[model samples]
Target: MLKVVVTGPLAVGKTTFVSTVSEIKSRHTEERMTQAGALVDQLDGYRADGEAAKTHTTVGTDFGRLTLDERMVLYLFGSPGQQRFRVLWDDLVRGALGVLVLVDTSRLEAAFEVMDMVEAADVPYAVGVNRFPTSPVHSLGSVRAALDLSPGTPLISVDARDRDECLDALIAMTRHVLAPLESV
Candidate 1:
């Protein structure tokens, strides 16, 4: 079995990505937003569910599983987006084979922290640009440059809500994770 992390900034669709790709039902530790959190969270560029504002947030990690073959299975962990929840990252990345960093075009820089966490975890990672309906067009080269990504790092566009796109992203990440093993 392989363990992978699906992580990104708030409302970037980590939950939707896991839900779309997992063969089995996903477990979520979500809670309704309360007035107490008003000062704790930011509401910038929030466009989930087409609601004027997002209400629910993941308090803990979201878990799901996907079967690649009879002998292969992928365990997916989706992370909470807020910086306050960063303490959970180290634990969540344990035994993870790789990380799939989802980037929101509108908020590309928001993914920096997630990428840093992946590096800290000492795992291979690929960046997937999660497309939103309102997202403006950005060239891949610009994205690569903006993120200061090495030329070899995999960067692909994906729709977190689309199964095929998620599958493609997963495939890319798997390849990246295994490349070192294959070369050795």
Candidate 2:
């Protein structure tokens, strides 16, 4: 089994992205961390489903499993985004194959910290721009410039709520992680 961790800044669509692609139901541990800041986290045009209710905070993490094909089974770990919970990153990434760093174009800088953490851990990763319906469209070049990524880094736009888009992002990450071997 391959461990895959999805991480990003608060409300970057990590949970939604996982839910879209996972064959098994994605487990969510989200609870309202702060009632006062509820308005701040809202994604402009995005809202949770009717059945969704804020818990308190994701004290631990969200877990899910996805079967990419007959040969690979992916276990996904969704880590909380707030800096206060950053201490959990090491544990969550312990055996991860690679990470999917989701970013919101409106808050592109929010992904910098997460990217730094993953790079420090020496894990291969790909960046996914989670596009919000209300967000202004930005070219891939502009997004790459904002992230300051290397030319070889994979950067793709994804609708975190769309299954196919999420899968495409994961596939891109997988290819990145295996590129060295694929070229051999």
Candidate 3:
């Protein structure tokens, strides 16, 4: 089994992305933690609307499975974004091939902590910019510069609700992870 971890800041659509591409119904262990309680987790500009009703902040992790081909099965694990849950990252990332770090253009700074953590872990990762209704459209180059990503890093736009787009992102990560093995 190939493990793929989807990590990002709070409310950046990590769960939604996994749910979109997962073949089996994804299991999300999510509970709403009060915004007032966690000063580090900000809910600014988060609208409480129709979709908001179903929104869940991942308490631990979201689990999902996808069969990419006859020979490979991907196990998707989504990490909780709150600072307090940072401890769970090591456990989630162990033995994982790569990570897909979701980002919201409007809240780019929110993604910094998670991105830094992934880099520190020495895990190869690609950035998936989740397109939200209110998210501003920006060039990938600009977003990469803002994120200070290296030229080799892959960055792509995706709709969290679209299954094909989510699958494409996962495939990109797979290719990134496999390139070195193929060269060897």
Residues 1-184 of candidate 3 have per-residue lDDT tens digits of 8999999998888888888888899999988666564576677757422245334488899999998689988899999878889989998999999999999888899888999899999998999998888778999999999999998888989998999899889888888888889988
lDDT of 2 by residue, 45-131 (tens): 433332344444455688888986799899988888777778999999998999999988777877888889988999999999988
lDDT of 3 at 19: 85
Q: Which predicted model would earn the best lDDT?
A: 1
For each candidate, give its TM-score against the true structure. Answer: 0.94, 0.87, 0.93
> All predictions: root-mean-square deviation over Cα?
1.3, 3.3, 1.9
Instruction: Judge candidate 1 against the unseen true structure and give its global Cα lDDT, from 0 to 1.
Output: 0.88
Pairs that collide in candidate 1 are: none
TM-score of 2: 0.87
- Candidate 1 per-residue lDDT, tens place, 1-184, comes to 9899999888888999999998999999989988898787776757774555688888899999999889999999999998999989888988899899999878887888878877778888999998887777799899999999988889999988889999999999888878889988
lDDT of each: 0.88, 0.82, 0.87
> Which residue runs of candidate 3 sit more than 4 Å off their true CA positions?
35-38, 48-55
